[model samples]
Structure formats: C-alpha cells, structure tokens
Target: MMWKIQLFKLNFDHRERDAVLETVDSGWLTMGERILGFEAAFGDYLGHGARCTAVSNGTAALHMALLALDVGQGDEVIIPALTFVADANAVRMVGARPVLADCASRSDWNVSAESIARKITPRTKAVIVVHYAGFPCDMPAIAALCRERGLKLVEDVAHAPGASIAGQMCGTFGDVGCFSFFSNKNLSIGEGGMVVACDGNLSQRLRYLRSHGMTTLTLDRHKGRAATYDVAEPGLNYRMDEIRAAIGLVQLDKLPAGNLRRKELTERYRRNLAGSPLQMPFDNLSADVVSAYHILPVLLPQACDRMGVIEMLKTAGVQSSIHYLPFSGFTAYREYFTAQDAPLAEEICSRELTMPLYPTMSDREVDLVTGALLGAVA
Candidate 1:
C-alpha cells in the first residue's frame, strides 16, 4: 500500500540527469574514462589517500574483496546477523562460511567485538564488519582485535559511506572497505559500488579482478594506448558502466550535504519521539564517531504488537519497515545455523522498526509519523 511517507526516496535532480546525458553523448557506455574519474573522486572523498575500484554493485565489491584477501573454501568469515543478506551471500559465494555474530542491545545495534571473538576459530580467516544503519562500529577495538588475531578485515560500509570514527572514515580502518550505491542508499546511483584499500597491491588486485583480469582496459585501447590486451587470471565482469559512473560522480558531490541533512532530521526524530515507547540507537554513542544517518531504526517494546502497529500506521497514512531478521532465522539459513546463540540480535530483530528518514522529508511529515506511531503504540 502507498503511504503518505515512503521509507526512502531518491533525491536526484537535473545535475544527475545531465551527468547521465553527458555520458550518453560521449558514445562510450562501458567502463572507460568516466569510471576512472568516479573512482578518483571517490578515493579523494574517502580521504587517507585511499585507493578505490568501482564495481558493478556492493555484492560484487564484497566478493572481489574476499577474493583479493584469499578467503576461500574451508575459511570462516565472521559477520553480523543484523545486516542485509548480501553480506552473508558474498561469504558463501566465495566458498566461505559466514559465522554470524549477535549484535549488542538496541542502544548499540551493531555487532560487538566480544561477539566476534566468540565466533572465531582455527578456520576463521577474516571478519566482515558491517556498519549497520550508517553507524560506525567500534573500529578501534575491532581493528585491534583483528590485528591481534592476524585476520583480514573487510568493512561493509554500504550503510555508512560518510560515517567516521575518530575523524578517520569508516572504510579506512579495515583491510578492504566496500560501499553500495543502490537506489535506496544515501549516494544512490541505481546500481553501483566501490572498494577501497590503502595497500597498492590489494588495490591493483581489485582492479584486475573486476574486469575479467585484463592486463589493459578497453579505455586504453580506445585511447590508442594499447592495441591488444592479455588475460591475467579468471575474473568476473563486474565493471560499472559509464552512465552509472557519471551519476555516481554527481551523487558523490552531494553526499556530505545529504548526510548532514540526515543528521539534522535524525535529531528531529529524537526530539519528536521523546518519552515515547520506541528505543533509539546511538543515543549514547561516542563523540569521536559520526553516523552516516542512512536509516532511523527504533526498537518497539517486547510486548508491543509489531504487526498491529504496522497496520495502524498504515491506516494512519504512514509507512514503516523492518531493518532485517537475523540471518539464521530465515529458512534458507536456518538449516545452516541456529538462532539460539544470538539472543540480542534475535530479540532486536523481532522489535526493530525502520521509519521514514530521507533528505527531502519535511517537519510536518515527521510530526505525522510520530503522532501516528504514538497512537499506534497506545
């Protein structure tokens, strides 16, 4: 059903359209100069002299990072059970088992270092930490734990592109950081992603693995730089097209301001929902960390009727959603894992509800949502 307020919406304008048109007018739609420009600009935005490789999507970026880190069969990668399914699917795609970890309480919905430590074993090769709902995980402790265990770190920064910990960007703290530009993301480009790493060799591997392991790109041949190319190794055709790259460039420029707006709106949610039954995350977070504000998730009371609240909100012309269920709760994953261990994650999943929090939403809309929520939970 269509609600008065959608959970998320694209905020594109003439600039995005113009960028796509320019790419079309250039008559080169495949991976080429535009993609290179997007990668360079993304790297600059991420700071810390990051090296980036634009991929087809966030899933491809995760797969490539795993491949670059040499994670394969018989290896186990620890990840939060509270994230989108793509993270776990990527681990399985690489022939690795995803050792799901429980998130902390609602105040901190991200997986903690203690949960990660509990999941580690002799076969554990890496840890894929997801910055859930744009909030940066405890990078200092998580990074230190990774170092102590000699494990590769892959950060799934799909929700927290602009988020930082201690002034350093979220993606910069890990061995390889992945991002998504899906239509719902803060920096949406319909379908696109990027991977970043400080190590030049790892960056090179990511670049090579994105395009069938080609020794030279088609752009090189088009620009008369190379007449022929050689294949280096087996790789997937996970290259972003020039059209998406053009859109990405425009979206990148708007990200910082968009994130700021999201932060402002988040404050509004907190203020409006004050004394309400819903529990908000990141309320007592550290000063050094800043969230990307991609989502606004709240936990309903355990005894509250979740589906009844959703229906009531719908009747009141508001749209609400669930962030996710623990991966082990799904039938596909249930056979492989158990939910008994992830008590907090499972509990939070049952009560978590995502409300509308986009850049273009208005104060009246926020008031409507909060009013409807209060009435629903009453």
Candidate 2:
C-alpha cells in the first residue's frame, strides 16, 4: 500500500547511482576490491585498529560472530528479550540455548549488566547486548561484568553503527561487533553487514568464515595472488556482493550528517508528542554517548487501543510498526516461552510501537504522524 508518510525513505542521491553504475561497468562483481575498499573505509571509521569483515547481512554477521567465538552446542548465550529475533535465531543456529534477559526498565529499553548477571549460569558462554533503538547501552559496566565472569560479549549493533560510548565505537566495545546495512538502518545499503573484532586472531577467523572457510579469496586467485588454496574449516556463502559494498561506501560518507538530522528529527517527535498518551523510552543516556538515532520507538499507554490506533494511522496514509515482539512468546521458541524471566521485556514489548523515522523524513511528516497518533488515542 502507498503511504503519504511511509516507514522510511532512502537518503540516496546521484552519488549512490553513480557508484552502482561504476561498479557494474567495472565488471568485477562478487566480493572484490570494492568489498576490500568498503571494509577498509569502515574500519577507518571504526578506528582503534578494528579488524572489519563485511558479510552478507546482519544475521550472517551475528552467525559468523557466534561461530568465530566458539559459541555452540551446550553453551548458553544471553540475549535481550526485547530485541529483534535474529539474535535468538543465531544463537539457536549454533545449537546453543538462548537465555532471555529482561530489559533494564521502561526507560532504558536495553539489557543491563544487572539483568544479564541474573540470567548467567554455568553454561553461559556469551552475552549479546543490543543498543535498542540505537541508544548506547551501559557498555562499560557490561564489559566489566563480562570480563569478571570470563564470558564473551557480542554487540548486536544492527541498530547502531556510528553510536559510541566513552570515546569507543559501540561495536568495538565487545569481543565481536556486528553491524547491519539493511535498508532501514542508519547506514542503508539494502543488504549487507560488517563484523569487527579488536583481536587479530578473531578477525582472521571471521574473515575466513565469511568465505566458506577458505584460506584465500577468489579475488586473490583471480588476480594470481595465490595459485592454490585450502579449506581451513567449513563456512558459509556470507560474502557480500560488490554493488552493495560500493553503495555502502557512499552511505558511510553520508552517515554523520544523516545521524545529526535524525537527532534533530527525534527531538522534533518528542516535542510533538509531549502531552500525548505515548511515552518515549531510552532517554537520559550518558553525556559521552553518541547515538545514531537509527529508529524511533515509543511506548503506548497500557490498555490503550494500539491496534485501533494503528488502523486509524493507516486511514491517514501514515505507516507504523512494532520494533519487535518478544522472542520467548513466539511459537518457534516454545521451549523458552516463559516470560517470567523477562517480565519487564514482555511488558515493554506489549506496548512498544515503532513510528516512522528516517534521515530524509521532514518535520511536517513528524507532526503529521504525531497528530494522527494523538487523534487515534483521543
């Protein structure tokens, strides 16, 4: 269906088109120099000598991270109950159990060190913290806790790319940081992701894992860099294509300015909905924290007619969505279906509503969305 104000609009320009066209004309598609270039540019942006490996998508990044970290059968990985399903899905893929950790509270919306500690056990191998709605989690405390317990930390940075805390990039804070370049993310590239590690060994393992565990790349063989190769271990075809990599480079250049615009727009939405029934989550962040402002998610009042509000939004040509439903409540996770462990998460998930938020979205659109929501609630 068409929308006068859809969920998100691409921040594309002639540069993206030109990049795509040039990459197509070069005829060296499929994880070639463009992928390397994208990786290098991204690593430079990440800084602190981060070893960046671009992957097929966000899920692939998550899978590769878990695999590289050796989080497999009989191990338990702690994940936020309120995050996207991909986290639990990735953990499940590796034959590990997903221990659902409740959100910090109605305001933070992210899994905190306290919540994570409560869920830890003898089998717990890793803890994956999602910076929900692109707000930085209390990473310093989380990192300290992980270090104390000898557990691995993986960051689901799909919602946060340029976000940082304590002068360190979000992805760099953990052992393995995974970023998504999905169409709706802060860095929009349609279908791509990056996995970064501060450890050289882990980075090398991730690099090999992304390309079917081969010792050498096809691009290297094509360029006669290596005459023979060996399969170090079995891996997947999670290599990103050239087109998306080229597009990602362009997106990277535009990220900072775009994030600032999103920050401005986020404040606009807050002002517009000041007296509305909906309550915004993830506020009162640290002064050192820098958010990418990837998406805008607000909480509707309990017992309110959320579905009716959504339908009313549709009539006004506005589109909205739920950021997520708790993974525990899904049929796929029946064994782990108890919400008792993550009552806060279940409570927040029930009322969480994701409104339209994108860099290109205008103040007028923000007002329109808020106005429609207010009318629907009233």
Candidate 3:
C-alpha cells in the first residue's frame, strides 16, 4: 500500500541518470576509470591514508575484508546482534564462528565495549562493529580493548559514511572499514560497496580479491598497460561496475549536504515527538561525533502493540519500518547463538520502529508522520 510518507526515497536526479548513461555510452561497463575515480575520491574523503576498493555490494566488502585478514576456520568474529544479518553471515562465510554481542539499550542501540569484552575469548580474532543508524560506535574504547586483547577491529560502516567519532571517521578507526551504498543508505548508488584499510598491504590484498584474484584489472589490459594478467589466488566477481561507480561519485558529493538535511529533520523529530509516548533511540551522540543520520528509529512503549502502531500509521497515510530483528533471533543463526545471549538486543529489536527519514522528506511530511504517531498512541 502506498502512503503519504515513505520510509525512504532515493535522492537521485538527472545527474545520476546522466552518469549512468555516459558510462553506457563509453562502452566500459565493468570496473574501469569510473571505479578508480570513485575509490580515489572516497579515499580522499576518508582521509588518514585510507584506501578504498570498490566492490559489488556491502556484503562483498565485508567478506573481502575478512578474507584479506585471514579470518578462517576455528577463529571467531564478534559482532553486535542488532545489525543486519550480513555481518554474522560474512563471518560464517569466512569459515569463522560469529560470537554475537548485545547492544547497550533501547536508548543506545550500539554495542558497548563491555558487551564486546564479555564475548571475547581466546578464539576471538576480531570484532565487527556496526555504526547502527549512523550513530558512531565508541571506537576509542573498543579499539583500546582490541589492542589489549590483540584482536583485529573491522568496522561495518554501512550506516555511516561521513559519520565521525571524536573527529575521526568511523571507517578509518578500525583495521578494515566496510561500507555499503544500498538504495536507502546515506550514500546510495543503487548497489555498491567499498572497503577501506589503513594498511597498504591489506588494501592491496582487498583490491586483488575484489576481482577474482587477478594480478591486473581488465582496464589495464584494455588500455595496453599490461600484456597479460595472472590469477594470483581464488577471488570472487565482486568488482563494482562503472555505472554504479559513476553514480557513487555523484552520491558521495552530496553526502555532507544530505547529512546536514537529515540532522535538521532528526532535530525536528526530536522536538515534535517530545512528551510523546514513543521512546527515542540514540540521542546521546557525543559533541565530537557527526552522525550520517541514516535513520530515525524510536522504541515503542511496551504497553503499545508494535504491529498495531505500524498498521495505525499506515491507515493514517504514514509508513514505518523495523531497523532489524536480532541476528541471533533468526532461524539460521539461532543454533549459533541463543536469545538469552543478547537480552538488550532482543528487547530493542522487538520495540524499535523506524520512521520515514530521507534527504528528500519535507517538513510537512515529517509533521504528518509525527502527528500520526502521536494520535495513534493516544
């Protein structure tokens, strides 16, 4: 059913269309100069000598990062249970066990250092931290713990691209920073992803692994820069196409302004929802952090019916979504972890409701959704 307000809308324009059309016209649709330009531009945006390898999607980025780090059989990767299932699946794909961590609370949906510490064991090779809903995780504390325990840190930065914590970018603080450019993300490009690594060697490995372990890209061969290429090792066809890369370059340019707009909308939600029954989530961002403002999820009161609220909103011409169901709560992952493993995650998952938030949403739309929510609960 269509609603007056949508959960999200793509912030595309003729520019994205022109970029894709131009790529098609060039007859270079695979990994090419556009991908390289996107990577270089993203690297500069990431700063701190961060290098990016454009991939097919966010899941590919995470998988490549894990493979590049040699996280394999018998090893365990700890990740928060509150994020999308891809994080846990990536660990499993690498032949590693995923030890689920819990989010702090409904008010703060990110995994705390304490949660990570509890899940860490001798087999824990790394920790994958998701910057849930664009809120930066406590990277400094988590990094310190990883250092103390000699564990690698991988950042699942799908929700955060320009987001910063303590003046440092979210993707740059960890060993490997994986990003997604899904249709609804802050940096949407239809379907694309990137992996950033501070270590040059690791970054090189990621680049090689992104395109089937080829010693050289097809672009090099096409340009006559290389006579032939060799397959160094097994890799996947995870390379980002030229059209998506072109679109990503455009989206990347708009991210800062878009995030500013989201911030304004989020503040409006905070003000409009004040004294209302719904509980707001993740309003405790430190002064030093700049969130991507990817989503606005409020926790419904326990006394209220979650589905009833969503249906009410729909009847009132508003749309809503759930950020996620705890990964451990899913059938595929249940055997690997139990509901009791992350109590807070399970609690938040049941109540969390994502309100419509996007760069193109109008003030009137925001007001409509908020007013509908208020009347629904009332």
> How well is each residue in 1-378 modelled by candidate 3, as lDDT tens digits?
777898999999999999989999999998899999999999999898999899999999999999998999999999998989999999999999999899877678899899899998889999999999999988999999999999999999999999997778989998999999999999998888999999998898898888888999888999999999898888888988899999999999999999999999999999999888787887777689899999998988886788998999999889899989877667898788877888888888888889999998999999989999988877
* Candidate 1 TM-score, C-alpha based: 0.98
What TM-score number comes out for model 2?
0.98
Candidate 1 residue lDDT tens string, 120-235: 99999999999999999999999999999999999999999999988899899999999999999999999999999999999988988999999998889989999999888888
Which ten residues in a row are the worst by lDDT in model 2?
277-286
List the pairs of residues colliding in candidate 2: none
- In angstroms, the error of model 2 at 109 is 0.3
Model 2 / residue 246 / CA error / Å: 0.3
Which candidate tops lDDT? 2
Residues 6-26 of candidate 2: C-alpha lDDT, one tens digit per residue: 989999999999999999999
How many pairs collide in each candidate, listed in order? Answer: 0, 0, 0
Candidate 1, position 178, lDDT: 97
